[model samples]
Target: MDRRQLEYFLAIVQTGGFTSAGRRLRVAQPSLSQAIRALERDLGTPLFDRLGRGVGLTAAGEALVRPAKQVLRDFATARASVESVLGLTGGRLDIVALTTLAVDPLAALIGRFRAAHERVDVRVTDPELDNAVTGMVLEGDCELGLAESPGGVEGLDHLRLRDQEFFAVLPPGSAIDPAHPIEVAELAGWALVSTPEGTAMRTLVDRELGRCGAAPRVAVETTHRAAIVPLVLAGAGATVLPPRLAEDAAGRGAVVVPTTPRLVHGAVMMWRSGQLSPAARAFVELARLDETALPPAGTAGPTRSP
Candidate 1:
């Protein structure tokens, strides 16, 4: 099947309907349908099954997703190789980031990368699952991934960007004194605003709390990482957060304090092991420079809560 057919197929999968995919691709609905039909004929199988007004991927379509994405990424990389002669005048860089690490290092690195390569379009998306960043990067869904990789992934090249320290964030007017570090066990009595179980953050929280022989009294469990701070601020419950986020929460009137046995994780950038596109290489280099500017892991002193 042609690249157009693959593009149309993926677009339909992403947008959830042929009409929506047509609008996204600026193609007529009939043409998009014809392209998919042609692709299915070439493969001798239907890729998508009609479901009322929507469509769902059939087994064949599910099987094609990874290879289709890889093919498209390879095509883009080929084009980028030729375009490199012009020095990153324009290209797309797709990144999948863990929800927790997305705002701090990713945002800062992207800001610097964009400042230097204004024409490059950087698209950042969250992984479907907390630990799915590596799989997404390996599957060619993204060129780069930012994740909590205490031990780097086996098949990918990685650069440890920073060590993140987790802190206890309490709601406004918390009786706990900010000057004193708190033990994880002390948090067991209070309800927590946490991400769902199985998420990286929740797993860490559970492990630490379990160490104290206490389980979290979860008052609010949300999949939306962004809402944790707000929920805590609203006095729903306390939460565990990284230093950067905890500091922000403090600035916004939440009480932040270091934990007795500090919770820390290494954040790393991962990519395919071989040669990278010029834009991706430049981004990696920028990350390296940024990392160097920061205080070495564990050396950076604790942030005093506001």
Candidate 2:
């Protein structure tokens, strides 16, 4: 019904109960309940169903979630627009990136962007699935998203930032030479520690392995990005990952062998196909500058950084 009511509803949904939402929003429980009840009345429906442990959204509440979020986004955009006219007073940039990339290009870019526009806020969202990054952008949940080889998403404008090389993460006491590139066939029949299926890196590795005439015998599949390091280190099995992650783990005495054909993954910065907020545009420009200044892929960047 109103911005405050919508805010309250969203908070309750996120925190899972009126009391929790009140604690998060620093509002009294009774006041938060009253606001949501008023919103439900205005819409002529029950937004939440009371349950013993926690409240769950009713069908009507589920329907209102997207539009309510959009309303809040628009309000933030409107405020930022007026403030920008008065010279970058208050603005925010919301970005979504893959968990692996949170270490590289995204970190450097964020650091540099913040230095220039200290007043503008920047938030990064890392979703579990690779597709969710672009989905967030397309759904108007975020202003920018970093996706790897986003294949033909209908309504996105993207720029290729870099192509990153992949490395073979050898288990402890691996016989493979760490100083040289490991040939494709070397991966055959090895029990591999891997990320879950459908992740960008996992998909790429699977395709490349197939091309090299082998299939991975997955020993363990995990969703956490950092879990691979410990798996390989503990001698679970060999794995393939972006160079940054592989090299970082190598410092722990894990052998990281390069692939013969140079397994490389492409990264793109994508956004919705429309005009962007001033803060978003500024972030893009900063990325462009950083990309130009960066050394050719595999030569420098997070993977190569000491």
Candidate 3:
């Protein structure tokens, strides 16, 4: 059968009905039904048994389902591969994030990658809008997506390659007993400057705060990680920050305190196997920081948050 017929058939199987399948495929319902019928007739067997409003895949149809999906996926992959060769390192590069990742190693990785793949053009999109990114990737609008781990995209492979833990950024010269790491309730004593209350990272922070028997005293809330450092530097209050974002702040009078419940943040790479741009694939491979949090580049400085 032609790719069009194959695509319609697969859509039908995936959506579990002719109408829904046609909607997803963006083809008229009758047209999709006709294509499926043509495919079944050409194969000389009933592909699906229509029982009332529901339909079940027949033995032969079940057999075709797996290979059908592969055919469609492979076809899309081939198209992307061809397009990639024509441009960025022979393909296009696009990215998405969740605010947190936009701040740190993503820039580092992109800079290093562009230096190596000078011919490859890369475009970085705002990290706030992930739904659009996922939709585009699924529809082959972009070559790759970087996002939070635990994304629920079907039919795509996601590789989680980087991780960082939450560290409390203490205000410059604020005194905390060095013997015992501060508890959450004690943390509440400090004016709290943090990300917005309902954000993903904030939610995790709240949960951990509850676990440690303390409620955060809300002082200043912002989505900006860079702002967190200055707020703390001005003695606004303590806030949770990733180690990389708090980098070298100790010298600037900021203390990175490690928290006990370990609020580690992670980044995942999402891409389907196909023809991929060398730049995109390299970013995926090289961008994921060592998931294993290593010893810091220097000796014990201001202690990281518990």
Candidate 4:
């Protein structure tokens, strides 16, 4: 019913209870409850079902979630527009990136953005799934999202940033020669330190290995990106990684080599197709400039919804 009520409602949803939401928003529990009650009354329906020590969204609440978030996002954008006159001296940019791409490109991209707008706070989160990036941006949970291009959602605009090349990383003292590229078939029967199934990297690895009449013998399946290289180094198994990460693994005594014919995917930056907050706009411009020096890949430039 109001911005404050919507904020309180979303906070409760995010933190999973009124008590935790109160802690997060620094509002007293009674006041937070009163705000939600007022909102539910105005909407003519109860938003949440009372559960012992916690809460669950009612059908009405579930329906309001997306629009509520969009309203808050628009309000913030409106404020940001007025604040733009003060320059990029202060603001916050929220971004969600695919777990696999977070380190290689997102880290460097954030580094450059911070160098220019040092006062702006940048927050980055990883999506639960590869396709969830588009949903997060569309629902206004994030101003920007980085994921594999040819996004699954339709209401967002995309900028093709760069192409990431995958390589095979083997443990120390492996018989493979670093100078020679290996074929996908050769990796068959070997244990692999892999991310869980359905991840972008895992999908690519599976498809490629499947082509060679083999399936991954997953030695360790984990969501922890940082542990992959270490596991490979520990001789858990070989894993596929992007070039930047593979290079780092090589420096740490892991044998890194390119797969024959090469495995590559296009990394993209995506946003809702509407007015953007100043910080988000500046981040997009920064990406555009960064892309200019690199060779073009899929889509060639920014693409928008019809």
Query: Model-by-model lDDT, in order?
Result: 0.87, 0.81, 0.67, 0.85
The predicted structure with the larger lDDT, 1 or 3, is 1
Sequence-dependent TM-score of model 3: 0.60
Model 1: pairs clashing at backbone N, Cα or C within 3 Å: none
Clashes of each: 0, 0, 13, 0
Q: Which runs of model 2 end up more than 4 angstroms from their true locations?
A: 89-91, 149-152, 300-306
How would the candidate models be sorted by lDDT, starting from the highest?
1, 4, 2, 3
Ten-residue stretch with the least lDDT total in model 3: 297-306
Per-residue C-alpha lDDT of model 3 across residues 72-188, encoded as one tens digit per residue: 656655665676566444444666655556665567667877776677667767644344555556555455666555755685677765565666678866666433455655666
Residue 177, model 1: lDDT of: 87
Can you write out model 4's per-residue Cα lDDT over 1-306, one digit (the tens) per residue?
A: 789999999999998899999999999999999999999899999999889999999999999999999999999888888988988878799999987678867888899999989999999998777878888898899999998868545888888877887888889888887777788777777799988886888888888888878888887999887899899989999988876677678888888777776777888899999899999999999888888876643222111111
TM match of model 2 to true structure: 0.87
lDDT (Cα, 0-100) at 29 in candidate 4: 98
Q: Who wins the lDDT comparison?
A: 1
Q: Output the TM-score of candidate 1.
A: 0.90
Name the candidate, 2 or 3, with the larger TM-score value. Answer: 2
- Error (Å) of candidate 2 at residue 149 is 4.3
Per-residue C-alpha lDDT of model 2 across residues 1-306, encoded as one tens digit per residue = 788998888888888998899999999988988888888888899999999869999999899988888778777777877778877666778999987677777888999888888888888998888878877887777889988856567988887887877788887677765667778677867888888888877887788889988887888899877788898889888887776677688778788777788888889998877667788888888888888888877774223112
Q: For model 3, what is the C-alpha lDDT against the true structure?
A: 0.67
Flag clash pairs in model 2.
none
